[model samples]
Structure formats: C-alpha cells, structure tokens
Target: MAIGPTIGTGLFIGAGQALAVGGPASLLLSYIILSILTLAMTTSMAEVSTHLPSQHGTLVTNGYMYMSKSFAFASAYLRWYTLALFVPYEITSAMVNLGLWKPGSTIAIRLAIITTIVVGCNFLPERLFKSSERLFTAIKIGTMATLFVLSLALGLGGVDAQPPWGFKYWKHPGAMNEYLVRGVWGQVLAFLQCLFDGSIAFAFAPELIVHHAEMPASLMPASVGEAAILSASIPGIVKSDVAQTAFPYILSSLAMGVMAPFNDTRLTNNGTGSGSSPYLIGLRDAKLQIVPTIAMVAILLSAVASGRSFLYLSSRTLCAMSELGHAPSAFSTRNRGNVPYLAVVASALFSSLAFVSVKIPSTIMNTYLLRLVTSACFISSLVSCATYIRFNRRLRAKGMAKRYSSSLQPFATYFGMVISTLLLLGSGLWVAPNGNLTGSRAIRLIVSYVNIGVFSLLFLVHLFKDFVSVAEVDKQMDLGGRSYGNRAGPREPRTQKMHPHRGGVYAIPEASGASDLRVRQTMFTEP
Candidate 1:
C-alpha cells in the first residue's frame, strides 16, 4: 500500500534530472538520507497513531489533537492542496511519457483523457476503487522488480557483446558534479539539490502508509497483510524493520545510479518519452529494441495509477477537514458508496493545472510543481514531528502504556525536524545570485517558496480567528487528552472502547455528565 502511491514518475522520470545535476554519488547519497528521514518520520507517526488511533487519519487531525487548532487548520489546507497539486504533477508526467511534452491540442486531449479516467475511478463504489488500487499496486511492484533486474543485468554485461560497465560511469563523471558555484561549496549545493529533487518521490509517503493502516477494515484490500500488521504492531514492525520496509526504495535508487551514467545527455534531454528516463536510456544504449517502448508504457500506466491514488487521498483529506470545520461542510456529505463525491470533484478540479504544461515546457512545469509540492511536504513533516513530540510528552506525563514504542523516539523525531527544516529553507537556493537573475528566475524563486508564505498566512489567519490564549490551549492539551474540544473543568480518565467495525480498541475520554453521543461527537470536533 505504501509503495502504491510512493513510487511514481518522480523515481522513473524525475530522477533523470537529479542525475543530471548531482551525478550518481549525490543521487545515491541523497536517497539514503531521504530514506533515513522517511523511516524516522514514519516510525514516529506509527508510534503516535498506534497509541491513540483516529478515524480521521494522522496528518492534520493529529496536529489538532496534540498541537494547536491553528496548526491543524493550516496543515489541513496545506496537505489538501499538496495532494491536489500532485494530481497535475503526475498528469504532466504522463504527458511527458506520452511524448506530448509541448503545448498543443494533443496535450490538451491527452490531459482530458487521463484526467477523466483518474477522476472517474474515484467515483466508483469503494470496493471497486480498492480493487483497482491493488491491481495497479501489483503492476507497480512488478515494474520495479523488472527494472531492478534489468539494471543489475546491464551492469553485469548481460547485453549481447557489451563489456561489464560496473561503476565505470561513476568513475568517469567523478561521482560528483559542481552546481551554481565551483568547488567544495558547489558540490555541497549539488548534494542539497539532489536531496530536494529526490524528496518529491518520498513526499508524504509515511502519512499515506499510516492512513491506509487506519482505514476501516471493509475498505482495506484482502492481500495487504502489512496494513493489518501495522494496526496491530506498528512500532515493532516499523522500528525493527525500517531498513527492510525501505528496501524497495533503496534498491530502486541504486538501480537508477547503475543503469546509466550521470553525464548522459539523454538524462537531461528534453526529447520524447524514453529519452527522459535514465533506465530506458540505458536500455536503448544497449542496442535493444521494443523493451524501452514497453517500459515506457508501463511507466505511463504507473503515472496514471499514481494520479488516481493521490486524487483519492486528497479528496479524503478534504472530507476529513470538512468534518473538523476546517473546510466547507458540504465536502463531508457522502454518496451511495460512502464516497465523498463532492470532495472528489473539488480536488479533481486541480488536475486542470496539468494544462499549465501546454504553455511552459513540461520539464520546467514538472520542476515548478515538484518544488511547490515538496515545500508543502516539508511543512507537513515539520508539523508531524512537532505533534509527535508533544504527544510523546503527554503520554510520558500520564504514564500511559503505549501500544507501540520505539528506541528512536524523540531522537528520531528531532532528527526528522532538523532535516525537514534544512531542506525547506534550502529548496529555493538555486536562484541565489549565481549569475544574472532573469524574470524567469524571479518567477522560479517565488514558486519555490510560495507555499511557505501561504502556510504562514493560513496559520496567522486561523490563529487570530481561533483567539485562544497559549495558556488555555496548553491547559486543554493537558486536560483534553485524546479529545479536542472546548469543554472545561476536570474530566474523568480516558476509557478503552472497542471499535465496532475495525475490531480494534480505541480510547475516548470518559464524560463526567455528557451523553455518549456528545462525547463521541466532540472527540474530533473543533473547539
């Protein structure tokens, strides 16, 4: 389930750009660092969610539960738009894969076709959606496995008369490329750029995984035991097997580094389809035919599938926000299949942004969208880390027994917080006075940091409107425990309750005099 939405055009196609700018060494190193950060963030979330799982999933709802309403409101919108923008990012990627990288009616037609299919799938009954997701997830795993094997074979001289090329490209390109400036600082910048680029692939992956695990049992796929295991033993499974859990991502990164040299012009070539993929470039260089086209087709399908998944996630996030009064309440309405059709339509509208590529170059458009989404991802990560810290402190103070515990606690979350901040701050450094800054460069600079401005705007606006003093918020955090509401005075301790549908135990604050319905209603309702 994690791999379903996690692996997308970012790895298959966008990695080419990273290779071009940072070379193989930086690409590999950046991915490793990202893996570590992903694990840290994932385990921290798992620890929190497993202790007091929520029906609304872990992102902004957790912020509301453990942090402040303003943070939650800001992050809810931030996450909603982040996932919504991803629809176009993936759609634009599909356009690139279809060789329609230019502006025209052709791009428009293909955009409409892909958007229809993606949006249409979300309106399906819940069962059909889950089934389609599983099918596409299987295809993604198969494609990754095939690419890994092919990359390994190519590196070992499996091609018809080609000699073994193990590590040759790394040595020739000297493993590190200078960027912006020249010298050690340039290499540092190159590595940082790689981190920023690579982050797009892993963005919000942990949240997706936790969200899937938190899904009602009826909505989960039958074959996905990992979700069940996550519900039962998230801390143990994530803490002990983080490396194993991350193996596919790590292996895919290594496979890309081995498939082609970073200096290959094809890696940066703004040409059609296969030309933009380092893996496909390697296959073409081997004098092979048909296979590259086949691989491109697989990648196109993967992009479409990823777009569909992100659409579902974004819509659900919007629906959750609506339930909390952070968005229009109409979004909370459901159709016959229990799907939030209004939220789906609202989120799917952003897919039209993919048409922006019709005017701008697809590659450039992809990068801009990537930067926008990546910045939002950094903010989400920062918020999650902060929520985890406070939640952990609360648990410790109460001497509550945790369903999941990690040795990396607090430390892992702290590390994640620092890395997220550095990446967010450095994301737009490319426009820094390396040379003359043109109008286009100025636009790029604004696009890079625009999300940060938007997040601050949302937070301040909500902060003023919410108007709760810090002392009151802290007091609520202390007394409210697992619930988030405006209720005052001492309350009874939280009591364990069995979830009727999920068959798992959950905690709810014991109401001193409130009715059961009121207690349940106010659990996730805003103050």
Candidate 2:
C-alpha cells in the first residue's frame, strides 16, 4: 500500500540522471538524508495521528489541529491538486507508452480507457481494493527485483562475455559529479539536486502512512512500511546500470550511438517509454532484447498501478479537506461500497489537465508542471515537518511526551524543517540556470513559487475569517481537549472503529476491553 505509488517514474527512470550527475557517493548521501527525513517524518506523524485520530484527515488534518487552519488548507489544497493532476499525468504516460506498441491507437481512446480503468478499480469494495493494491504492488516489486538480479548478473560477467566490473565505475567517476558551478558550491548544488530528486521519489509516502496509523489490523505498522519503502529506493538506484555502468562507459556508449547522456534530447520526452532511460540503454548495450521487452511491459503495468494509487490518494485527500470544510461537501459523499464516488469523479475531471499537454507540446507542458509539482512537494514536506514540530510541542504541553514519545523528537523535527525549507527555496535553481529570468526561465520561476503565492492568498483569507495570532496558535497547541466537526478530541479516547470490510466489528485482542493505546504502542513503539 505504501510503496505502490511512491516509487514511480522518478525511481524507475529519473534515477539514472541522478546517478549520472551526482555519482554513487552523492546518490547514497542524498538518499541517506532523505531516508532519515522519511523516518523522522513518519515516526512523528504516527504519534500525531494516533494522538489526534480522524477518519477523513491525513497529515494535512493533523496540520490543522497543530498549526493554523490556513497552513493546513494550503498544504491540503496544493497536495490535493497535485495528486489529482498526477492521475492524468500517469494515465497519459501509460497511454503514450501503449503508443509505442499500439501505434494506431488514438490518444483520446487510450486516455478514456486508462481513466475508466483507474476509476473503476477504486470503485471496488474496500477489502478488494486493499487486496488488489497489495497484489499489484507485489508484482511491481517483483519486477524490480528481477531487474536487480539481471543487473548483478551482467555486471558479474554474465552474457556477452563482458569482463567482471566490480566497483570500478565508482573509482573512475570519483563518486561525486560537480554541477552548475565549481568546487564546493558545485558539490552543494549537486547534493541539493539529489535531495530534490529524492523528494520527488518520496513525495506522498507520509500522507498515505497517516491513513494506516489508525488501522490496527494492518499487516505492518505504517512507520515500518515507510522504512521498508524508503530502503527499497536505494537499491533501485544502485542496482541500475545508471550507477553500475560508470560515467566513462556512459559517455563512450553515447559516442557509439548505443546510449544517450543524462541531458540527452530524450530528457524532454515524457511517458513510460524508456527512450531516455539509461537502464534500457544498458540492457540494449548488453543485447538482452527479451528482458528489455518484458521490463517494458512490466513498467506499463507499474504506471497504471501508480495511477490507481494516486486516484485513491487524491480522492481521500479531497474527502479529508471536505471534512474540514476546505472543499465542497459533495466530495465527501460515499457509496454503499465505501468509495467516495463524487470525490473520485472530481479528481478524475481535474486529472484531465494532462490532456492539455497532448494539445500543447510535451516539452513545455512537462517543464511547466514539473516545477510546480516539485515545489509543491517541497512545501508539503516543510509543512509536514512544521506540523510535527507543533505536534511534539502539544504533547509536551499536555505532559504526555513520555506517553507518546517519538524516537527523534524535538531535534529531528527541527532538522527536517530546516532542510525542507532550504530545499523548497533553492529548488528554483532548476528554473533559471543563468540567473537571467526571461522567457521560459521567468515562467519556471512563477510556476515554482506559485504555490507559495497561492498559500499566501489562502492565509490572508484565513486571517479575514478566523484570524489566529502567534500566541493564539501557541495557546491552541494541545488538541487533546479541543473539538472539530463533532469528532471527539484527543483527550477523550474513542473506540477504534472497524472498516466496512471488517463487517463493522472491531478486531479484538486475546482479552476484550483492552486499551487501544496498548495495541498502538505494541505496533509502533521501538522494541
């Protein structure tokens, strides 16, 4: 459930570019920081979600409880919009990938089929949805594992009589590739780029984990699921020829028309086609036609699965927002199957924005939306960190820090916030390479920071309606006693409700009437 959509095209395709630009050492370090951030964010969120459980709210709901409503609304709005748009983005990519095989299929017909499949999957009963997601995600992971084994076999002198190349690439490329500037600053810029790419790969894991935090019957705790998913990303990169093939090899392959550079013209190419991917290039060089064909088919399924997950994510986020009065009430409507049909439809409609790219060129469309999406991801991370900071302070305020303590409390939250802020601000570097904001550069700047502007406007609206001062926000830190929309607050322990799939009966322990906190503690707390 957690890893399904999290490691999408970014980890599958964009990782090659990261490995090419930042090298193996830089890639490892960037992912290390991201992994730590993932841990800190997930652990803190687990505490907060359990502390202030809400059926419809995600991390965004926790944000509202701990911080200002405006901040929560901004985060939710941006996140919801991003996820909605991403659905079409994924489906469109799937359609285009299909184009590689079905050259005669019209984009319109393919888009309709893709959209129908995505929405229809969500309309399944809750139990079926969960099972289906698990199966597809298992397939995706299995496919990736197969790729890893193949990469190792080839690197270890399998097929084509290639000499065994063990860690030679790292030594030659020298582990860190400079970018933009020179010396220390260039390394800093490269590291930041790696972090940004990593964040894109790790975009919505935190939001989804917040949902699992309250599900006692889940196979694994959300925090554990997050750690597993984040750990998988490292291997996804390192195992690829993107990291294994070495920089000199990549350059030489390009020279021989066997591969393209990281900044190849194919970079502008979108969709699931591996035209720009170094992984496919490496396979082609190895002359493994059968495996590449199988991988392509698997990647198509992977894209559709990601689209399905994003549909779930977007609708749920909208439902959460609607619960908080941030979206229309119609969005909160649900069917007998426990699916939010209205929210699903609304999100799908918004996802049609991907068709706009079909009309206008792919390069411009990707360039424009990618910046906005990347910036939103950074802002969302920063907001999550801030919300975690406030959540910890609230726990301490109520003297429940020991009761619901986070492993990296206080310091981790602060550190994550600082790093998130820097990434959000410096992400605009991709916008204006020469620092001259004109033409596309100017558009990129606006697109990158447009979320900030929208957030500001939303914050101003919040001020006009329910103005909250800094001191007031501080005073309202403790959510254990407050009320929101008829739901019980954190102080009043509510019974854990079973999902519709559970036949509306809560799963009991060996002894009934046992405390829910004990179950959560057993599931989440470090042994």
Candidate 3:
C-alpha cells in the first residue's frame, strides 16, 4: 500500500520537472532535506501509534483523546476528504497514461470504468484485499529494482552513445540551475522551488507508519525505521536515474541539467502520464522496445494498485470518523465480510470528480490537484505532530515517558511541525508564477488552501453540534488505559486479551437529525 501508488508519476514522471528546474545538485540536496523532514513525521507517527493503537487508529482519534473535540472533528473530516480525492487523481493519471497508447480516447468512459472496478474490489473480504495488496506491493518493488539495475546499466555506457555518463552534465550545468529572479536570490528561489515541487512525491506517506503502530515495540523499531528509510530513498534513486541515464540519454533534446528543458513540449506538465517520463525517455533512447512497453504497463498497474489502496484507506478513515461520531453511523456499518462497504462506496464517489479533468486541460487540472493534495497533506502532517506532542505530555504526566523510547521525540515532532506549518502557509506561492498576489494569484491561493477553509468549517460545524471545553477534553482523556503500557520498553509473554469494544474517553450528544453521529470507541489490542 505504501510502495504502490507512492512510486507513481510523482517520482517517475515528476522528477524530471524537479531536475529541470533545480538541476542535479540542488534537486539532490533538496530531496535529502525533505527526506529527513519526512522521517521526522514518520517517527512521530510511530510513537503515537505505539502509544495509542486503535482499530481505526488516526490523527482524528488522537486529536480527540489529547486535544479538543473541535480539533478532532476537523482532523477527521480533512483526512477523509483529502484521501477521497486521491482515488480520482490516480484514476485520472491512469487515464492519461492510457492516452499514451491511444490518443484522443474517451477519458470519461475509461475513468468511470476504472473507478467502478476499484470500488467493486473493495467489497471483497479483508483477507482478499490484503493478499492482493501484498501482490501489488511485491510487483511494484520488483519494478523499482528493475529500474535501478537497468538505469545503472545504461549509465555505464550500455548503449554506444557519447562518452560514458559519469556526472558529465553535472559539471557542465555545474549542478544547480537558476530560477525566477537571478543572483543569490534566484539560487534561493531555485532551491525552494525544488523543495516544493519535490514534496508531492512524499505526501501522505509518513502516515503509513500508523498502520503498523499496533505491533509490539520490539517489532516496531524495524518497521518504523524501514518506512522512513524507504520513503527517503525514493527521490534519491529517481534523481540518480535522471543524473545517470535520463538527462544523458538525449542531451541535445534536453537543457543544460541533462534533462528536457522546462518548456519541453513532450514533458507531462500536469505531473501525470509516463509518456514523457525520464526513465521512459532513457529506455526509448537505448532502443529497448519491449522493456519500455513493460515499464508503461508497470506504471499503469501501480496506479491501479494505488487507487485500490486509497479506497481501502478511505474506507478505514470513514470507519474512524464513524467510531468518533463525526460521520454517519451508516458509514460505520460493516458487511458480513467485515468490510465497511458504505464508506468504501462513499469514498469512491470522489473519483467521479476526475471527470472534471475531461473538460479542463490535463496540465491545469494536474497542477490544481497537485497543489490541493500537497496543502492538505502538509496540514495533516502538522496535525499529527501536534497530536504527538500532546500525547507525550500526557505520558509524562503519568510518569510513563521513560518507559517509552524518546529517541527522536519532542525534537522531531517540534521540527516537523514548524516545517510543515511554514510549507502549508507558503504552498500557495507555487501556484503563482510571479510572487505578486494579483487576481489570479488571489484565486490560486484560495483554491490551493480551500482545504483549510473546509477544515475550519468542519470544526465550526462540530462546535455547533458538540461543543466541549479544552479543560474537559484533557481531563476526560484515558491516558491511564492498559494499551499505553504496550510501549517498546516492556515485553510480557502473557496472552494479551483483545478488547474490541473499548469505550471512548468522552462522548458528544447527537445534533438534531444527526442520529448516525452516535459515537463508539472501538480499539485494537495486541496479543
């Protein structure tokens, strides 16, 4: 699930754009920096999940337990909504990929067909979903390994092209490419551009650690460490691909950084589609006929797998909302197969929004969707950090802080919060070509941050329905639960009892005509 959609066009197709604007050295450095920040987020999430594992473990639940009810409501809605859009975005990208094989195809039909299939698959039993996810993840990993080896071979002068590519372009381009205003300011802007542009690739990934937070502390160290390391490696490997093979493959068609010029007509400006991918470009240049086809098919399958996973996650998020009483109880309903089919279908409906892409230019829609996703993800990351800080405080209050690992604690949480908050604030600037806030600029800011307004509205709506004081929220929180003792510091051979119907720390009255908002606090316990 983490590896599938994550390795989609963002790294494969979008890396070229990052390479084009930031050059090799700048892109490489920026990615390394972002990777650390991403690790900070993953580590923080691991701590919370370790400390407070729930059947529907989410920042939303953590928010309610450690913060205000309003905060919880906003977090829950934001996550469900943000995650819902990903289904359509991946589907749309897949349609664009299909365009590569058959130009001017009817996108609407293809999108609907694909979305239906993804939604239908979610209705299957949980074990089947897990099995298929494992298969897709394995295939995706194999694809990446193949890419690394093939690109490495190409970099070693596998083709009888120019001189053996050994960072030759890096010397010519001198690593960094200048952007926006010139001089030192331009360099600063160029680096920031790379940072912002490259960020989308890693969005929502750190949250994956939460999925495994229920495991034993001893088991967590490896999974938590591996999640961060794997995510951080994404940009490094892709940047290396461009540095070694993509840029060097067709130097004449590309700009100074050994990548196609920023304005290259072939580049997928929308940040979707593999038609113009640097890896595909290298494959084409090397005259590998069958391999390029296989690579494209792999990309398509990755998109499908990612779409499927997003649906699975969306349903889970909805279940969390239902359990928290922020969403309709119907969404909490499970089929005989134990599938939250209502939430699955509700989430899949967001994919219908992809039809809007059919009318708008692919590049325009891509930019809008990319910025939207980036902003929401940054907001969600900050929420995670805040929740972790509050959770730690509760642990310390109960004298359990020492019982848990503080390896990267407060520092990473604080650092990630600050960085994510700053990025979320400035994310709108990327939408505007010039920094000036003109009419289009103003609109772009609103569009990019529409999620913030929506989240705030959600908080207000919750306030109207179930208002609670901050003091009460903290006082009622169940910090003393036995689940908190399941930290990494201690281990027991006793068979831990599994309690599926643990009560919540607090409950809110249902708003008028909001019967489905009835709350239940079901949690996951390790055995």
Candidate 4:
C-alpha cells in the first residue's frame, strides 16, 4: 500500500513514450539506475525518520529540523505544487486510457467526471478513505502481477497457440534506437531521454514511503527494545519494498521489448487506448480476444486510483505546510470527518488544468507535465540527501543512538546528491541541438528547467524574510538590554540550555537565570 502511487500510469501508459525514444535496452537500463538511486535515498530517509518521526511528513518537517528554515520553505512549496500538478497528470493519463486522447467535448466531459471522482474521494471520512486506498492499492498490485504473468505466458508461447517469440523484436529492431540523429551519438541521446522519462514512475517515491511510516495506522515501537528491533528490520523492509516495486517494472520492460518493437507506430499513437500498449499489441497480434479489453479496463482503473492517491498526498502536504506556519492557517482546518477539507479543495483546483488537453493532445500534455514533475522530484531528492548529511553529523556530535542506521550510509547519500544534481541539470538536454529552435522545442526546454528557477525564487524570498526578522530581533535585544542595565544598575547574564525533542530544538533558561530564554531553534539537534 505504501507503494501505491509509485506504480501507476507512469509505468502502464507513460512507458510507451520511453520505449518509443530509448528502445528496450535503454528503458531497462534507465529504470535499473533509477531504482538503485531510489533505494539508496529511501534507506537513508528511513534511518532518519525512524529515529524521530513527525506528525507531518518527513519531507515537510525534516528540512527545517535538520537543515535551515529557508531550505524548508522552498522545498515544501516546491513539493506542494509538484504534488498538485500530479493530480492533473494522472487524470490526463486516465483520459488517455479511456480512448479520449484528443482534446474535445467528450474528452472534457470525461476529464470532469474523473477529476470529480479523484478529488471527491479525499473528502471522505478518514476510515473510509483508508479503506478505499487499500482497495485501490490491491487493484494496482493485482494488475501488475497479472501483467507480469501475461508477459511471461506470451513470451514463452503459452498463450493462444502462438509460437514462442522470445526476444524476436529485440534482435530485429536492435536493443537501442537512435533519436533525433543516427549512430552512437543518437543512441546516447536516447539513453539520456529514457532516464528523464523513466524517472516519473519513481518520482517522490522515498517521500511516499516515509509518509506512510509516519501514519497513525502504522505500527510504532512501544519500547526501546521494540525500537531496536524495528530499526534492525528497516534495511530488510527497504530492500524488500524496492525489489517488490522494481522487479515488476524490469520484467515488464523485458516483456515489452519482446512483445512489440520500439519502431511500432501504434505505441506512439495518440488515441487508441489499450491499442497503444505493447501487451495489448502482442495479445492482439496473437489473435487473443477479450484479454486486451480486460487489460484496458484494468489500466483505466489503475490510472483513476493513482490520481486519487496523488490528490490525497497533495492535500495533506498543503495541510502540513499550514501547520508549520508556511501557509495560511485556514488551509489546515478540518471537517468533522477529520479531513483537511480546505486543503483538499485548494489542491483539487489544479485538476482543472487537465482540461488543457482539450486543446492539446493528451500525449503532449502528459509529456509537458511529466517533465515538470520529474524536475521537481530531482530537486526534492537532492534536498533530502543534503538534509540527511546534516542529520548524520548532528547525531554524531550529540553521541546519540540511532533507531535505524544504513550500512551504505554517507556514500549512499553522497551518491544521491551527485546523481540528483546531474539529472536536474541535464533534464533539458534531450531537446537536441539542430541549430533550429522550433516553438515546440523551446517550450519543452522551458518546461524542463522552470522548476529550478521557481525553487531559487522561493529560497531567496524566504532567506530575505529570515534576514529581516533576525535583524529586528537583534535591534529589540539591544534596546531592552540598555534599558534594563540603566534601571537595575547591572543585569545578570542568563545561562541558556538547549533541549532537543522529536518535534524540534528549543532553548530553555536555567532555573538560576534572571529571566527565561525561550528561543525557537531550527537547526539540527540530538533527539
């Protein structure tokens, strides 16, 4: 269930685009690299989160607690809009799955209906929402399992009397495809493009797992011994979760490589629903009936389920920001059902953007949104690694015991930081260098790198505000000290003690001090 959003339309529908650009070899390689990166990132995060869980998700609270307020502000808002944008991204994908790829009145109506279902689910009572989520998660897992079995059956010639065509497409069309140009340079470009496109399937996955761990329903350790036991099991949990999520993808990629060649125009076609799917293509080619339709229905449900889960995540993220004083308090308000109704409403507003597909094809719109979401994901991953480094240092300084510690440690975090930076910087390089800056290419370039600009703007704005606040605090302290000295002849120096808690750091005055020193410390401290 924690992996619900990770396995979605991105794998089922968006992989078509990746397969189109990179061919089989690139698709397999890209996902493998991304999976390793994600595993490292998640293990590091789990180590930190298990030590001191937060009511608000670790993605929102960890930056402020372990790093700086300004970084927290920028990353939180960046994550907010990124998750918000995902609502429309999934909805658009669902529309495409429903044979409504081109923008029109029918597509618009379907969009509205699906959007309503996705957003409406979030407003349900907490128990009901959880039940629905579990149900959908089951469906997603089942669909994946079924597809994998089908892929194996089809590949081994176990379906509909068709001859075994093991790796036939891979051998003929070759392992990799050339993109924009021909030969080695083009293959390199195709691999890079696959890395970018394939990222969507695993975007924000670490954050999702951390959030799931912090949920009330999750089992929490009841004592120090229990905590130690939980900590010892974390690495196993991380590895198992990663394998469960990644193996299906790798198998599916291999299956697709055998099922349909990269050059098949149907894979890139605009409006054929499951017809564009390699699995369906293979099944239909084998003269298998009824199964493709069933698979199409499953894909459609998976998309809608993914959209609903993303809407839930986006709304909760907004609510967390409000709780942390980064957004309006009204956004944190909840109804009797314990739903953050205001935040849900605010986040749901972005789903209207799905209608933009009415003017543009859903395929193009999905690509644009995928670029933006993946860019945000890269930045967030980079920040998480940086935060973990600070957290690790603070724990060492305080000589504190960790509830969970990964063996891959500092190396993993460092690797994550380096890879994330490279990915973010190279995101737009897929646009190609033809000496002609076409309008479509220009738009793609902007969409690819726009999140970096937005993140910088947010960070600077918060940094300036923090600077002003500190200056004012210093000014007030100066005047107050002078006034007190004149009135009392001399003032006693206060002895302040630092106390670290699970929530954050606080400065407490010693009992012998003249006055209480109640300061809010945002930097990392031992818990």
The C-alpha RMSD in Å for every predicted model, in order, reads: 7.8, 10.3, 11.8, 6.0
TM-score-best of 1 and 2: 1
Write one digit per residue (lDDT tens) for candidate 2, span 1-527. Answer: 44554445555544544555565666666666665666666655555555444445455556656676566767778788788766765665565445544455366666677778887898897678878888887887676656665666666666666655555555664656677888988877876776665455556655555554444322223334442343233222222312222232222222212122334434325321122344455565578758766776776787788888888888888886775566889888888888888888888786676666456533344345455666777777778778777766766787763324555676777777887788789877666354322246667678778888877787677656553443344354445545354445454433332211101112233355332211221122111
Number of clashes in every candidate structure? 0, 0, 2, 0
Query: Which order, best to worst by TM-score?
Result: 4, 1, 3, 2
Off by over 4 Å in 2: 95-109, 168-174, 217-275, 324-326, 361-364, 399-402, 434-439, 467-527
* lDDT for position 188 in model 3: 75
Write model 3 residue lDDT over 232-314, tens digit each, in one string. 34333323332332222123112213433343435544333123555566676667768888987886777777778888888
Error of 2 at 338 (Å): 2.5
**What lDDT is obtained when candidate 2 is compared to the true structure?**
0.58
Best model number under TM-score = 4
Q: List the residue pairs that clash in candidate 4.
A: none
Q: Candidate 4 regions off by >4 Å?
A: 100-105, 214-228, 270-275, 433-439, 473-527
lDDT (C-alpha) at residue 500 in model 3: 25
TM value for model 2: 0.73
C-alpha lDDT of candidate 3 relative to the true structure: 0.63
Q: Quote the lDDT for 78 in model 2.
A: 77
lDDT of each: 0.76, 0.58, 0.63, 0.76
Q: For candidate 4, what is the total of clashing residue pairs? A: 0
Q: RMSD to the native, candidate 1?
A: 7.8
